[model samples]
Target: MKMFWVLTLAGILVAGMGSRDGAVAQTRVPQKVMKYLESHSFQDLVRRYGNTTIELSVPSREARYLDSLPYRLEAGFRVQVVATTDKQNASNIYRQVKQLQLDSTYLVQEQGLFKVQVGNFTVRDSARKLLDQLYYAGFKDAWIAPATIHIAKKAKVLPTPSDSIYFAIQVMATHSRSKAEETAQTIRKKWNLPVRILAEGNLFKVLAGNFSEESMARQQLQYLREHGWPDAWLTQLLPN
Candidate 1:
């Protein structure tokens, strides 16, 4: 009976392998699978997992870089010059207001209208001052409006020891430092993980987790990929 069972298992394994091989030979690879294969290259895998140096301390150059990024959004105020459904009219007004060069001017489209806003002020009084300036500058309709505004990020203090080797999950990379900082903040708030932004050349990489174990970093990487970051990967940080 034991020999009979062994023969049956061997026959099943052989049949399964033959069927799989036949299917592979007969069918074309699915487009999605092919696209995934094309997008994920061996070079990418090596870049993420290969031995690389990590500066545990923020260098002065990187410190200045981080200081330029938007830190966080806060309840703030802005001077709204106009909100009109006419796109051409809005464009004209935006161009005129932009010529004044009062502050960071933005022509934002929302709720079927283009709204021109200026200056990110944490205090309503500061926004009111801008509004007054706009009125004198021929934008009489400008008024202070409550809004969310970006503040410059302070220099980051890395917690990892300079001599320690650790693993981290790199969630994303972007050329925009502000966008990278925003993504890092969102991941930190959502997952409550220790997030770090690494500026390499022109790209800012957002990485989470300072795990001592590769297994733990892999687990976090899986979680991030399942949640939203499909391209998230585990990276080892070697002491520099």
Candidate 2:
């Protein structure tokens, strides 16, 4: 009975080897066998592992701020009037210019220094002209420092006022009504000078004195610098 069982096993092994050899000689797996193996293997893998889930989480703050930066960079020029470690000095400069109704004037604190800047001029010449005016305004330390001025847009200077051909000491221009009023009031009370807050286009222009002659305006401008106002420039109103 044991010999009979051994013979039976040998016959089964021989039959399997013969079938494999025949398949090798044919150089191809049977289509049904290949299909069965692929389907079964994939199904088994999916059953064992497909139900597994990977949970991904990111910091809420990082996710919220991923699309934007805290500060923006822009290509432009601005006249840096003064930079000092003293906040009061910077604020004083700011008030002086703001009183002149200069729209783009700002007091910024950076690197332990308070900086006062003015204008968002695209052209270097524009900044230079402003720098010249600032120098006379009493900020002799003022110069054109090329920088990305922090502002929405540059203030547009309107057409010349149509009052008459009179030259006035142009102090500054500002877009803020409160700033214009504040500056005008300070100059009026402090110096008792003739202060005119003219609305020329989008800007409120602060003029010190109106002169019928350019020469007289220049002389007055000089006197203004000698007193306290330095950024005064001789400007012709109602140009011919």
Top candidate on lDDT is 1
lDDT of candidate 2 over 43-111, digit per residue (tens): 564554454432224345554564243223467678898889989878987899878655357787778
Where's the lowest-lDDT run of ten residues in candidate 2? Answer: 1-10
State the displacement of the C-alpha of residue 30, model 1, in Å, after optimal TM-score superposition: 25
Task: Report the C-alpha displacement of residue 48, candidate 1, in angstroms.
Answer: 32
Q: Would you list the clashing residue pairs of candidate 1?
A: none
lDDT of 1 by residue, 18-75 (tens): 2212331223444774575467665663555344322223246666775555455568
Candidate 2, 103: how far from true, in Å? 2.2
Q: Which ten residues in a row have the lowest lDDT in candidate 1?
A: 1-10
Please state the error at residue 122 of candidate 1 in Å. 1.2
Please give the TM-score that candidate 1 achieves against the real structure.
0.37
Q: Rate the local accuracy (lDDT) of all candidates.
A: 0.66, 0.60
Model 2: lDDT to the true structure? 0.60
What is the Cα-based TM-score of model 2?
Answer: 0.36
